[model samples]
Target chain A: MHSIDFIVLFGTLLAIALYGTWKTRKSHDLKGYLLGDNSMKWGTIGLSVMATQASAITFLSTPGQAYQDGMGFVQFYFGMPIAMIILSAVVVPLYFKLKVYTAYEFLEQRFDLKSRALAAFLFLVSRGLAAGITIYAPAIILTAILNWDINITILIIGVLVIIYTVSGGTKAVAETQKQQMVVIMAGMFVAFVVLLVKLPDHIGFKESLVVAGKMGKMNVIDWKFDPTNRYNIWSGLTAALFLFLAYFGTDQSQVQRYLSGKSIKEIRLGLLFNGVFKIPMQFSILLIGVLVFIFYQFTMPPIFFNKTETDKLATSKYEQQYNELSKQHQQVFDQKRVLLGELVAADKAGDEESTTQLTERVNKLQEQQESIKAEAVGLMQDINPDLDSKDSDYVFITFVMKYLPHGIIGLLMAVIFSAAMSSTSSELNALGSTTVIDFYKRMVNDSATDAHYLFMSRLFTVFWGILALLFAVFATQLDNLIQAVNILGSVFYGPILGIFIVAFGVKYVKANAVFVATVISEGIIVWLYFLSRAGKLGITYLWFNPIGALLVVAIAVVLQAVWPKKTT
Target chain B: MLKNDSFMDFLKTPEYTEAPVLGNWKAFYLTSIIFFVVELLLFSYLTIAY
Candidate 1:
């Protein structure tokens, strides 16, 4: 990035963090530190809930996804509103009824202390690593674009979030999140309009969608019953429902957002507000990606988006071969754009056979582009033999740096950093709260006063922030932040949601049945995960949430009936 | 001045409600239908028209 861009981006983030710390410096007790003193309105709660969930991955990788795939990935959230409704009517009230600090706290009241500890342990492990990935998301980029050390970037961003979060606690997180959401939305909107303006005049927005549509990027809904299809209606509805429940219901990051509300009704209103807005927000972001894909159609893009490897090739003997390949790659872009124009004209003229032929030819040219990219990656590996070649994560950033103008580019860059901070800050804040209220204060030192717990909460926040920084330094080893968060959620969200479903929905299921069933269910789910990854099972990873939840609930119910206990 | 209150009474336990379970279900369904209509309209414009 140029000097001006860097100034605007980092300056905005630092200013917001400083503002948050100043705004809520008086949170001197446990309730204020952990739960924001139960004084937030539905608007702050609503925006915080959305901001907490909207990670840097949502900004960076999702548009890249839309550029490649269209708008269908949004089906994954079809279950969210249903899940939200269930939470608003059921889960929110139960959490409020128990007057708990963390969602896992209720598991002990309704079941046993072991259940609470188990749930909290699951949350810490899942959210802690996720916090690391969130930190990694934008840090990886700042290091890449700024040509700085990746570890330095990670530490810089990590400390920025930790300082305010540790000092001001939950109020700091919510207040900063509110401002961050405003910047995030405004930046993204400007980026979207800028991307649109950068497109060619003749190939307007409608024509661009037609080209994307012809490429089969607009498949928004798939009613097919295939378990392997990741974003189809069935996987999205049932499996996504359980995943949402586990995430928004049992997960502390989300649960704590609403748990800070002053009343159950406000909590419901806040959650339901999110339910209504989230899917469309995601769809809009993905739509921006799809538009970016079309923007690259007329324009020539990098053969390999991962500049780190591309830089390595610049010094190697293979640089000559990479240059030759780039010439061919440019030719492929010329051919693809020519074919897309013909395809648009053919469809406009109502020529069925010509349209089909144009689509086929266009797809073949697209494949040629992919093959050239594959060749570039292969050449890069030959240049350094140990380089990571999967560059899907770098696609969007490469586009922005190459195509966008200066000021807007900086704002979009700020959007991504904001997303990373929002998600990472929430994760650190949640991890600290859980560790203090659910574990340290609850188990080790139950007699501590509010001020003492508040201190511990801030202490743990700083500790987790450092840990997440370490995680970010190693994040480049992973493919992308978006995939990282989903993969992490798929691992633990299922079994945790299963226990809660039994607790709330099936009241008679014995604790022993649940405890035993969770272990067995998790084992089987792991087996299924391996099978699917090995291509042995046909089920997609999205289906794992429902499958795991159903397995535990079904088995526990059967087990509870078999070993009936006397009424309490 | 900041006024903070612990919301102990906000928990709507099943027994705390005056309405019957079936009535609550009806209210839920009604709320859901309203949500569906609003969402359907919102996305239809946000997608096709935008």
Candidate 2:
């Protein structure tokens, strides 16, 4: 990156952080620290909620996902709007009525201390691990593209978030996130426009989209019923419904975002706004990736997008073999380009038969190219078993670094860092609040002053920030950081949402029964997940949320009927 | 007349309150659901037309 990029990146990030800290400097009580004095409007709350969930991975990995897989991933969010409506209609008013600082606080009031503690514990484990991933996702890509040390990248992001979050708490996170969301969206829109502008003169936007559609990148909706298919409409509506319910309704990081709103109306508006806008936002990001895929058709892309690993292979004993594979890939590309020109001509001339024939031929050539690419990846894996050979995550950043202007490159980098910081800050804030409110204040010092609680809140924020940084360092061992975060959430969110479901709907099921049910259900979910991983089961992870939740409710009801009630 | 009054009472349940923009909670919910339907249709159209 040039000096211009550095200036823009650091200047934008530091200004947001400093502004948040300054704005919330006097928030010295527990309420202000944890819930932003319960004064945020819908607009701020909505943007904050979006920013918290977007994360660095959403910006970095999602485009790569589209570049590789296609637009079917957008279906995964079909359930989000439904989830938001349910939360607004059912969950928001309940929380407001309870005047709760955390979602778990309502659980304790409805169920018992053990139930609340269990739900909070699940959230802590899942979101804590996910916070590390939010930092690690950007760090790994930046390290690969910029040649920066991964550890330093992790440290820079972790420490920068902790400063404002520890200083000003929830208000700080929410306030800064408003600005971060602006930067993130602006950068993405700029990238999209630049990709269009950078396309070959022969290919206009509509023609490029036609090319992409012909190549199967525009398959946005799949209606076929398959339980194991991850992104089909059924799974998106069913399993994803339960997952989003758990995430937006029970996850402390998100719950805390809206809880800081001025009233139930404000919170509902904020959530509904998210529900309305989130799908289109994700579609846009994925569309940019598809556009990039089309752009690469006219211009040759790298054999492997991850240059660091490819460079390593080049200097090793496999250099000759790699060069041979590269030569073959170029031949395929040349053939495909010639076919593409004819296909574009055929398409423009409204010649349907030739278009179909050319499309099939081009697809065959593309498959041939993929096989050679796979062989090269296999060879690289043989040389270094530990290297991450999956290059989809590197596609967008590689394009950015090589193509975008200097100032905009820095702005895009800032977009990534802003996303990372926005998410990590919220996670730290929620972790600190849950630790202080659900465990420390409730159990350790029930009679502590507001001053004491506020101090503990800041201290816990710092503590969790440090813990997340450590986890980020360890996260390099994982494959595909975005999937890692989601899978972690899916594993734990089921039982936690089940606990809340019981508390909300199954009024007859007492605390002891639900608590026992939650423990057993979580154990079963973990075992089932392992079975699926080991190829012993055919279930997908998305199913885990609904299955885990329903198991708790059903088991809790049975246990409530059979087991003896115990006085607390 | 009695049934109509009871139906209105159900609509005026204490948990229900004024929405920020829409007239009431039910209206707000209806609007959100409508938005959801519109989005689904738009996506389906994109899938078919492309």
Candidate 3:
């Protein structure tokens, strides 16, 4: 990386963090600290909500996911628009009516203390761990790509987020996110434009799509109803609906974003903005991946995306084996390149028979190429079993580093760092608010002065930030920890959503029955997760949301029916 | 501020009846849904045609 790149990167990140801290330094009250004094407009809330969800890993892994699997992943977000509508029409108004600081506070009002505590505790466990991952996921990828020290990268992201978030609280998080979102979106747009410009002169936008489509990378919507399929029309529409409901409706991280809105209208409008734009944003990212795949078709891509692991393979005992595989991979690439030229020609000339024949040859070579790449990954795994063999996360950064110009590299890096901070700040801010509002204030001391609560909130924000940083540093040595954290989130999200569904929809089911049913449902969900892991169940992880959610409602309703009502 | 209404009553409130800026909540929601449907159609066409 150039010195100019380093300057641009640090300059952009520091300016946003310092600006956020300076802007909201005077927000001293609990409401101001936790809810931004209800001063945020719809635009800020909307961007903040998007920023909170779009972690660094989303930018890194998504395009890579598209490159490998195609655009079918876009279907995963099909439920978001309807989910937003539901939140705006129903959930937002209820939140406004209650005037609650945290979503869990509503549980206390609707059910009982135990129910609120249970929900709040689940959120703390899941989000607390996730806060670390938001920092660690990007830091690992950035360090790998840039050859920077992992510990330093983790500290820079974690401490930078902590500095502003601890200084100015929720308002700071919202304000900084506005700048971060600009960086992220602008960086991605620039990257996409550059990709288009760099493509072979013969391949215009339409031609590029044709090339991608012929390779089956343009497959966007899968109509099949396979229960085990992770992303399809059915899973996206149904399972993802429950997940979004739980995430946007019940999760404190997202709730805290819109809860900071100036008015109920702003909150509604803010959520609606996400609904309208999220799919397009995701599609654009995936398209960048497809474009990268096309670029690699003309120019030979590395046998594996992670150069660090592959670089080490040369010195290891498998040196001869790795070299042979590399030779095989290059031969496949050469043959595929010739076939692709013909395929493009056939496509241009409308030669149906030749197009079909050329496409088959190209695809066969592509399969052979992938098989060699898989062997390379297995060899890496054999060298060091602890290393994660999946290098999709490395794909985008590798492209940026190799292809993009110096200053643009820094800006893209800033885009990623900004994403890491944007998400971690919100997580820390939400964690602090939930700790104070849901647990500390309600359970420990409700009579504290506003200033005392504000002080404690800042203290808790610093506490969680440090804890997340600690987790991020420690997370480096663990294999497959990010996926484990994601699974942990899924396991808890359904049960949490289930509790909320019963609280909102099943009014006949009171507190005691719902609490017991939640415990039982949680146990059942955990068992199901293990069963699926053991290959005893054929369901995808997304299905866990609906199953767990319905289980809670079903169990609670049954329990409520048999149990006698209190004569209050 | 903390009114404990049934789920149906909550849905019946003015907050759900009309969007403050858009005037009608149902219309606003329909617009969002319609936008999403159009996006799906466009993507579907791309998939089949490409």
Candidate 4:
């Protein structure tokens, strides 16, 4: 909020946007505009792919997830490396050989016009709405924690992304993302080091880890196979594999990232780069949360991370009750702080029996603290019945705003804004290209000049950008923006991936069978998702990916056998 | 089905080039898988040891 911080944030963002627009200002041809003239190397393509996926929510809410649920969420990405390798080996070369502008174009050559349109329509519907959340998620949290106006925050992010992406097209998106990734990683690493330094002199890094682990914050892997459990090895390896495959292999936003590569070799290497480094990047972010948890053990964190809710509670009729709870919460924290010190000492001195005893006592006190906080949250809900009760999304930003230095605060804000722009730019760029290439050129105006198509691509980019901004302004009732986006993706990605899988693997299944099967499979998946949401079904969201895809494949096979298409 | 249209023929087209640093695409993929396995092992250790 300081002038210096504002300067740093805006200066960094404007510099990158201007640089990208100026660098690619000469783009005129449709191919050059849509595909970056195929000039990107593996490094730019790799970082662009990473940036498209790591939205503002990844940096803003992931640490909060770690703070609340521990590191088990890392399991969500366990399938990423395998998915990347599969894409590199099988999908990349075929795409290059086909020389398609959009991933759905290959579907038309393999199947028929209707199939391509169906897949492209599915992508536009799912990704269009998701682009809204990409901007809104960080804007909501940043504005709440920083006390900025929400509409201005949203416009700042959406308009800047639209400016660069509409100006330079894919080349601008890719070029700006390179600088954004540098800022994102540097800001996170600096925050990590600061979190370490902020710890008490007596509690070294090892002691901090010991405190966090015994307190159950270091849970990185869950080998259990429970289907309903969201984060486990089984779900990550099997179900998330389908999700990742659909996301990277079939989605236009990601497909366009690698499609801009100079050659098949460049694209494959780009994907492989993401494959090798994605997990480690995620691991470091989660570790920062664990460090924050340990830091809070020595210092008192807010009774509730979201001060906006608590601020309302201050004037409510239950103010006395909340005050009593806050007092009780402070006492519990004070008690646990002493016990955590003893627990760490016992572990350091190799006294296992004393360590176990101290751990139980400290955990009990921690539970008391949580119960008081939960009561406060209940009061907040009573006051405002429609308020989202999950405060985990506010945890990391609260820490950054309160504890981080001023200049660093600006840099971290830039980090969030950079992430927002990097991802939204890619989404708009892809949405525009898909509209022009897959629908407009193919259907509405097949004989247009190259200049006209290029102009339309830029026009559609702005069109989608405005639509995403309008959606962000209205996206206020969603619960846990990250999960909402992923759930939306899982609902549609399966059938799209299914159509592609059949196109590549099953030569016997014709266009009619696959198309009809996909329609039915999507209907089934959406129904199943609602059933699970209502607790009638016990399946997790990740299961939707494999379930929908397999349903399409199976139904297509059955339909093909029952009513075979006549060869003309 | 036509021979050129088969997925196997696409695989046999020899369009892929050598991977950067690793020289062979197979070697690069193998190394990537190996790196993934090591990460899993490291995470498991973090789960147990800490």
Candidate 5:
């Protein structure tokens, strides 16, 4: 990156962090530190909630996902609006009425201490791992751009997040996230416009869409009911619905965002804002990926987008084989580009016959390109067995660096780092709150002074931040960082949501029954995940949310019937 | 500013006499749902048209 890029990147990040710390520097008590003094307006709460969920990975990898798989991935969020509405209507009021610091505190009131601890433990495990990935996602960007070691990048992001989060707590996380979201949305909009301009002069936007559609990248929905299909409308509505319910209703990271609002009205409005805007925001991000895909159709993308791996192979013994693959890839792109030009012309002229024929040839060439790219990936794998051969994650940043102007490049980098910090701070804030309020405060010292508890809150933030950093440093074996984070959440969110579902809806099932059911449900979820991993189960990961929640409710009901009730 | 209402009391407390910004909670909810439907239709059109 040029000097302008560094200035934009560091200037944006440090400015937001310092602003957050300065704004919330006076927070000294548990309520102020953990709940932001309950003074945030709906807009701040809404933006913070959005920023926390749309982490660096969303900005970085989602476009690549769209480029590779198509826009059907947007289906994964179909359940979010419904989840948000439910949370706003049902969950937020409960938290507001109870005046709870963490979502798990509500579990204790409804069930028992053990149940609360179980849910909190589940959250800490899932979100702690996700915090690592949030850090790791932006680290990938810096590592690629600066050719720096991935560990150092992870440390840089982790340390920056820990500083503000541990200093100002939830207030800092929320305040900075508002600015970060603005930067993120602005940068993404700029990039999208740039992509449209970068397209071939002859291809107007509608024609570009037609080309992308003909190439199968415009697929936004599938009505298939197959459980194995990850992003179909059915799994999205059911499994993804359960996932969102669990995430927004039970996960402290999201719950904490809305809970900081000035009132229930503010909280509901904040959630409603996210529900209304989130899908559109996601669609636009994915569309940017589709635009990037179209841009590369006219201009040749690398045989593999991951330069770090490709550069190694370029000098290794496999260099000759890699060179052959590159030639084949270039040949396919050459043929495909010509066909795409014809396809666009035919599509523009409304000549169905030629459009169909050209589209068929273009798809055939795309298949050839994929095969050649696969061989190159195989060569990289052979060269270094530990390498991640998936190059889609590198697609967007590669485009930004090679194509975007210098100032915008820095803004985009800042956009990514801003996302990383926004999410990591929220996670660490939530983690610290949960660790203290639910576990440390309840289990260790229930009578600690406010000053002592405040210290513990900051201490726990640093602790979780370090833990997340360590996990990110070692988390190199995951597949498609975005999917890995979601899968991790899905595996645990189900049981936690189930515990809450029972606590809210299944009142007859007491704490003991729910607690036992939670354990069994978690075990079943893990077994199901392993079975699916081993090719024995065909269920998609999203389905785990509803399955686990339902299992807990069902088992708790059965156990409640059999177990004798004892008066406490 | 902490409300000490029980969960049952919370249920009894009317949540939406009116929304803070929008006309009413029902209107806001309906608007969000309508937005969702419009997005779905737009995406569906893209899918079929493409």
Candidate 6:
């Protein structure tokens, strides 16, 4: 980050944020603060909804994922469009007719207050912890690449979010998201163009893709049936379905996005818009990662992308041992590069057998690289027990710092900040709304005046913001922020989605069935997840969503029929 | 697609609308079938393709 670009980047971000605060300054009442007085149209609501879900993790780890894995991860979102359609058809109209401020509000009317509080508490606990991971995701990288102090970056991001949110409330969050989404999209386009220009001049896009294809990075459509395989077509469609259904239907952060819409129709349109574009947008980001993989083919990439580990290796007593691994890694890299060149030539010259041999050699080189990285990590662990060794999260940022020009570097930095703020602000905004409307006002004092609720909303916003910042400070144990949230959501979302699906779809089953079924489903899901992690079960995290939801629906129906209870 | 008026008949008929009595048996059955088919097809594709 040089002076000029840093100035432009900071100036632009601060201006947009300040402008949002100013624009929403007149939001004096509780409805104004929480729901923007229902003045926003579907377009703004749609963008805000997308921005909230497409957090800093979406920008950071996703591309890094694409760079390492290719566009196949996009398949995981294949179920999203269908889920969105279902939400629009069912959940939207239910909430609109009920005129509920929070999704949990309906649980009280439909079931009881205890059930409502249970759902709300679960949301607060999960969203609260997840917020920190989202904030820390981009901050860790910026700290590493620029050698900027991580704590300072974390504080700056936290304080900026707190300031604008404290001033303008949800109105500012929505307004700023509209602008942040634009900037994020534009900055990514710039990143993609810059990478294309950096590729070999004569190869063109097709050969670059062919290069990516020759590598295993082009595996887009894996129709694998293995439950443990996270990104195959099955896990993606099923697990992603549950995840999306729970997220858009039950989770307050997303529920509140549609809640702010003027009518059910507007809400439906907003959600439909997100559903249509979500998959394509993810595909594009993953494609950028695949391109980065191709970009490194012609360039020298570090033996390990995470500098924290390699730095430990440098100072270790086994520096000699580390040096040997480095040599082997470099030798393999060169060997692979030569073979890749030969593979491309052979492909062009129509030599099938030579192509086969070259493919084997390239795989051998990548395997050697992995072994070298693992050995180096082991040495670093021996040298200093406290050293961080994860490299998957650091790959894309390492590429950006080593290759991209200075001006665009600052823009990409802003993109990270934008993603963090957009997502965090949404979380804080939704948390405050749920607290005031669902808990404090509804359960504690349902007759509280609009002004009091509004004041409490701002109060909770500041409270949760501080809580998220505190969580971000201690979230160092998470290897990748993106994966951590999904893990949390997979456990919680399945049962939550099941509760809603049963509420709408299962007419005979009352809330006891769902409540009991949810408890059972959640227990089983957690047990299964732990078992899978321990290598006993083969279930993937994605499948947790559908499995838990279905389990609740199935169990709840049977339980209710066997042990009948009066309807609410 | 089910016609709006025809679909509306199941849920919004005057008798059911005036007094809540769970009148959408056909809609319930149809929706159940649809979800079953979708989930089954998705799983079947995975099993066969894998």
Over 4 Å off, model 2: A474-488, A564-568, B1-23
Candidate 3 per-residue lDDT, tens place, A32-89, comes to 9998999999999989999999999899999999889899999999999989998887
Error of 1 at A392 (Å): 2.6
Error of 3 at A97 (Å): 1.6
Give the worst 10-residue stretch by lDDT in candidate 3 chain A. Answer: A559-568
Per-residue accuracy of model 5 over A484-549 as CA lDDT, tens digit each: 666667688888888888877765778888889889998999889989989999888888889999
Query: Tens digits of per-residue lDDT for model 1 on A1-568?
Result: 7777888788888889999999998999888888899888888898999999998878877887777677878888888888888888767766775668898887776667777888899789878887887777667765676678888767766888899899888888889999999999998788788888988877887888778877777766666888777877677778888888888998898888888998776777788778877887887888888888888888888887777778878778887888898899999899888888888898879898999999999988988998988988888887677666766567778877877888767777788878888878888888999999889977899997878888889889988898888767766665566464656567677888899988777767767888888889888888888787789999887777887888889998888888877322
True contacts kept of each: 0.02, 0.38, 0.54, 0.48, 0.52, 0.00
Q: Residue by residue across A1-568, what tens digits does model 4's lDDT show?
A: 7889999999999999999999999998999999999999999999999999999889888988888888999898889989998888778877877788999988887777899899999889879889998888888888888888888899999998899899999999999999999999999999999998899888988898788889898889998899999999889998999999999999999999999999888898899899889999998888888888888898999888888889999888998998898889889999998888788788989999999999999989988888888888899999999778788889888888889999999999999999999999999999999999999999999998999999999999999999999888877755566465666676998888899888778878888899999999999998999899999999898899999999999999889998895520
Candidate 4: what is its chain A TM-score?
Answer: 0.98
Residue A444 miss distance in model 2 (angstroms): 0.7
In order of DockQ, best first, we have 3, 5, 4, 2, 1, 6
What is the lDDT for A166 in model 6? 77
Query: Chain B alone, TM-score of each model?
Result: 0.45, 0.53, 0.55, 0.53, 0.57, 0.49
Off by over 4 Å in 4: A477-487, A566-568, B1-23
DockQ of 3: 0.45
Residue A140, candidate 3: Cα error in Å is 1.5
Clashes of each: 0, 0, 0, 0, 0, 1
**Candidate ranking (lDDT, best to worst):** 3, 4, 2, 5, 1, 6
Query: Per-candidate DockQ versus the true complex?
Result: 0.11, 0.22, 0.45, 0.38, 0.39, 0.06
Candidate 3 i-RMS (Å)? 3.8
In CAPRI terms, model 5 is classed as acceptable
Cα error of candidate 5 at position A99, Å? 0.5
Worst 10 residues of 6 chain A by lDDT: A477-486
Docking class of 1: incorrect
Measured against the true structure, the TM-scores of the candidates, in listed sequence, are 0.91, 0.95, 0.96, 0.96, 0.95, 0.89
